[model samples]
Target: LFHTLSFFYMLSSFTSSKISYHYHFINIRKNWTEAQRFCREMYTDLATVENAKEMNNLLKSIKDLSYDVYIGLYRSNDFKWHWTLSDSFYNGEIFKNSKHISNNESCAAMDNNWKWFNDNCDSQKQFVCFNGKICY
Candidate 1:
């Protein structure tokens, strides 16, 4: 019985160690591009959503936005939509209901239903930071 308990405890510790909550919140009034640059200066990029869980965490951490906040999704120089911070190409796994406000809108935003929206990168709003990094 003691050996079993010890094994469970070890398992629990191992699991917890693999899981990391590196999210950091930042309230800044800056344009999307500026915010991205700010995040880059901090050694990590903006919030990248690899799944729904990360998306929800980001949404929950952010407050009510009077304006759209810039997310990590954007068009690459190749004219393909890609996450600004992630090496993995988005396979349309998340933000399936996303819509573009206008074709000119380059930055992605989390709108209703945690959907993505393309808006002008110059819009002022609060942005989120994650991956053991923070930016003003």
Candidate 2:
């Protein structure tokens, strides 16, 4: 009986700790900075694609893949890649090519192929936002 109770407790804890996120695709085209501002005002920060699952979710949320969309990825002044979402779980698996050849290419966007690429921040594009919830 004690073992069963412990197992149940563990299962409950595990289930409760799982983080769930709802992705929202905004079809309105805007620059990366504008998209980030809009996301912060409306929902959470711009979408953060951490893994294949998140990428798949993002792809599914968009009805049209004919155009690219801005994501939360950007390069700091030091040229290090970072996400607008502070707690993003990035493991470097989604970038098709990690090389950023141009210094002006600081912002990132998702292509039709679901791969990420660097782009100018001022270029207009649609974007995705996410609202994350911690289940209890």
Candidate 3:
């Protein structure tokens, strides 16, 4: 009886720690900074895609495929990249293969190809947001 109870407790703990995120696509066009502000006020924050799975989920959430959208990634004045959602999972290899990235670009956006690309932060674009609660 003790062993069975222990197994159940462990199972419950595992299930509770598993987090599921919800992605929200906002169609209004705005610059990266404005997009971030809007997301904070309305939903959570700019979308943070940490891995291939989250990237796929983000793509699936968007209803319109007509235009590119801003994401949470941006580089500070010193050129250090960071996500607006500070707790976002970081994937170092995310932009390794992207040929579109240039040294001057600091903001990130999801193009029609569903891949990340560096863009000018001042460019107006639609953006996505995720719930602030981290499931894990």
Candidate 4:
């Protein structure tokens, strides 16, 4: 009912010895779970959009924005938002109390308008992947 997305980022503002990875946009469409599996096997994990700059950059990376994509965001059974890739694996304080259209919308995706929305986790769509050991 939902597709997965891939997102990669680098520490550009600061200096680091770790490898700087890039965000790769996979055109292949797959459900959120499938996309996450693929990303874990090949790259780091699904794309983790942190700030407005990253979101805008991610939207711009996709040449064709006619369709939405699955990001590395999801909701737990208890209704907590989380990113796929993280060291501490902290829960997202944001969207903790936000209302959604449906309780079935447990996955997060970005539409063609560069807007984030709740979606069914089974929806298949293109995704972005992140790469790098330094990224959170």
Clash totals for all models, in order?
Answer: 0, 0, 0, 18
Report the C-alpha lDDT of model 1 over 12-78, residue by residue, as the tens digit.
Answer: 2121122233555567777777888887787377777654445457767765645456777776545
- The better candidate by TM-score, 1 or 2, is 2
Give the number of the best model, judged by lDDT: 2
| Model 4, residue 73: C-alpha shift (Å) | 0.4
User: How many steric clashes does model 4 contain?
Assistant: 18
What is the C-alpha lDDT profile of model 3 across 4-60, one tens digit per residue?
Answer: 223223222221223455789998999988999998898888887554456567878
Cα distance off (Å), candidate 3, residue 58: 0.6
Error of 3 at 101 (Å): 8.2
Model 1 lDDT on a 0 to 1 scale: 0.57
lDDT of each: 0.57, 0.69, 0.68, 0.67
Minimum summed lDDT over a 10-residue window in model 1 is located at 10-19
- Per-candidate TM equals 0.63, 0.74, 0.71, 0.70
Superposed model 3: Cα runs more than 4 Å off: 1-19, 87-104
Whichever of 3 and 4 has more TM-score, that candidate is 3
Q: Give the worst 10-residue stretch by lDDT in candidate 2.
A: 8-17
- Predict model 3's lDDT versus the native: 0.68
